[model samples]
Target: MIACSAELYCAADLLTRASLGELDVDIVAIVSDKPAAGELAAQHGVPFRLVDGGLAGDSRAEQEAAFAAVLDELEPDLVVLARYMRILPEAITVRWNGRMINIHHSFLPAFAGAKPYHRAHQRGVKLIGATAHYVTAELDAGPIIAQGITPVSHRDEVEDLVRKGRDVERTTLANAVRLHLEHRVLVWDNRTCVFA
Candidate 1:
């Protein structure tokens, strides 16, 4: 598995027990600019490779090249973006295709972008949730695999809502990854039917 964000550490820990050596999913490499992410990889004894350029501002060619370099070196079977905050080029998306997945902070087709917790708070919604889906070029607009929702109250603040949302996010993403690893998710017309 190729983990791209901090939340991936949690996913990795979860996988350690669930796969029970069946997958033996070694975290071949991790890409992040954050020191904490690097530290986590080091603690887990996984090799860390830093992206050479800024993902958001770098040209598509540069980003693709960098991603290709990592793929060449890691040759990961699956790419999991656990809160990695960068848009992937279409070339890479097509190359990896179904082998990639991402976790979003909101039930997709609703709050699909960043600050979803704040968006839910502003809307005064009574429930907030997270979505896990395939990594399509259309940001957060991918086939849904799994989701988890939690109720909010009138007294809840943005931070409180985000805190509650994190738990759901972690569990939902883990479930999605497990299903994908087990080949239990079948995609059809931008939607998913997961066995789990």
Candidate 2:
């Protein structure tokens, strides 16, 4: 559970599944500042923690230091950013390097960053999608891991597109994480060669 952003309940579902050994991984720790997100971690019997609160306006170095401490405790082989809104520091990006992943709400190299569904709706795109990729300093411009798409039409509103996008985001992220945990995804020069 990250910032507890929209559709964060998916985090609960993913972590629950992972706890049940569906992904052959363990939820060593979950870091979020929100009580609700922390509760999700607790419900899954995962240790919950917090990093930069944003109210202090901490520098990237400070934030990275805090995050490093958390990772030190968890010793996770991979870092998954599910609905985590903050753009991480280059230090943390480089430190984690190929071990980190994120799920974006857009098909990517397209409407990235905040509110992609709204932008796609405004542009009248026939299809909107989600992407999961290795985390790098270049924001959403990272090595592609997986992509999931769903069709939409002129009649669909932004809200409808958002609802549909959530489904894509959830499944795409889950699949990417599962592939990574299973050692089925290989990264090479900003692209992924998935074995399955």
Candidate 3:
């Protein structure tokens, strides 16, 4: 697994699972656009690469080339975007279409991007959730693999929702990764047929 993230929670969960033999993944290396994830990788004894939004170099084509070179060097079977902040270029997305997945902090197709908990709170939603899906070029609109929700009330602040959402994200992302690795997910027409 090659996890890309600026935060440590998801990557830490994955690394811990792999260490405990709970997940059947090696977690060979970690790539991040930020240094926080690099610190986590170091703690876990995994190789770390600091790429610019998972791509390196100054120009678009050069960045793509650098991304390709990194992937080529790692030869990862799967790439997990564990709350990776930057938007990936389309070429990279297309190149690893089926082999990549991402954990979005919202239930998806609703609060698709950025500060989803805040939006959810503003809308007075009764439940906050997380979505894990294939990393298509179309943001969070990719085929959904797993979703989890936690009930919330008017009394719940944004921080409360974020806290609850993180737990959901962790579990949902892990489940999606497990399904993908176990060959239980089948994709067709931008939708997923998960056998779990």
Candidate 4:
């Protein structure tokens, strides 16, 4: 399992649960570009590697090389982006394709860019949700595997929506990862059929 995020305290908790036999998966390694993230990885007792040049500034070649190095070293069957917050280059996306998964903070095709929760709120949408999908070259556009929705009341603010959306994000991502690991997801025409 790959843990990415400053608030990966959630990821750490999930990893601990998995380690305690709550989930039938092996977390081979954890990667982060932040020092605090690395500290959290250490607290979880998992080996950690730091990606070079952070996420945004790194050129396509640099980012791809860094991820490729990790893939070569870890040899994971799949790469899960647990809030890594980086737009992967097409070269890397094509290389991993269906094997790479990402969790987006919106129901997707709805708010496909940054600050999706805020966008949903600004648009006065009745519901805010999260989507889990395969990593594709085009931004958040990908084959959607699963999604979770939460009711957004008129009383809710952007922060409230974001907080609720984070819950859905974690669950959606974990569900998608589980389905992918079990070989229960099939992609067709920019969507997915999950059998579980």
Winner on TM-score (1 vs 4): 4
- By summed lDDT, the worst window of 10 consecutive residues in model 1 runs over 10-19
Better of 3 and 4 by TM-score: 3
- Write one digit per residue (lDDT tens) for candidate 1, span 1-196: 5556545544454445444764445667667644467776676677787664454577656765876788877778888887777788887787887888888899777888888989999999999999988988888898888989999998999999988988888888778877888889999989888785
In TM-score terms, candidate 3 sits at 0.92
- lDDT of the structure predicted as candidate 4: 0.80
TM-score of each model, in listed order: 0.87, 0.90, 0.92, 0.90
RMSD of each: 2.8, 2.1, 2.2, 2.2
lDDT of 2 by residue, 111-167 (tens): 978889999999999999999999899989999889999999999999999889888
Best by TM-score: 3
Q: List the residue pairs that clash in candidate 4.
A: none
Which residue runs does candidate 4 get wrong by more than 4 Å? 54-60
Which of candidates 3 and 4 reaches a greater lDDT? 3
Model 1 — TM-score against the truth?
Answer: 0.87
Q: For each candidate, what is the lDDT?
A: 0.76, 0.80, 0.85, 0.80
Best by lDDT: 3
Tens digits of per-residue lDDT, candidate 3, 1-196, equal: 5656556788888888888887899887887766677788888899997766434336646545656778889889999988877677888889899998999999888899899999999999999899999988888888999999999999999999999999999999999999998999999999999995
- Stretches off by above 4 angstroms in model 1 are 5-24, 55-61
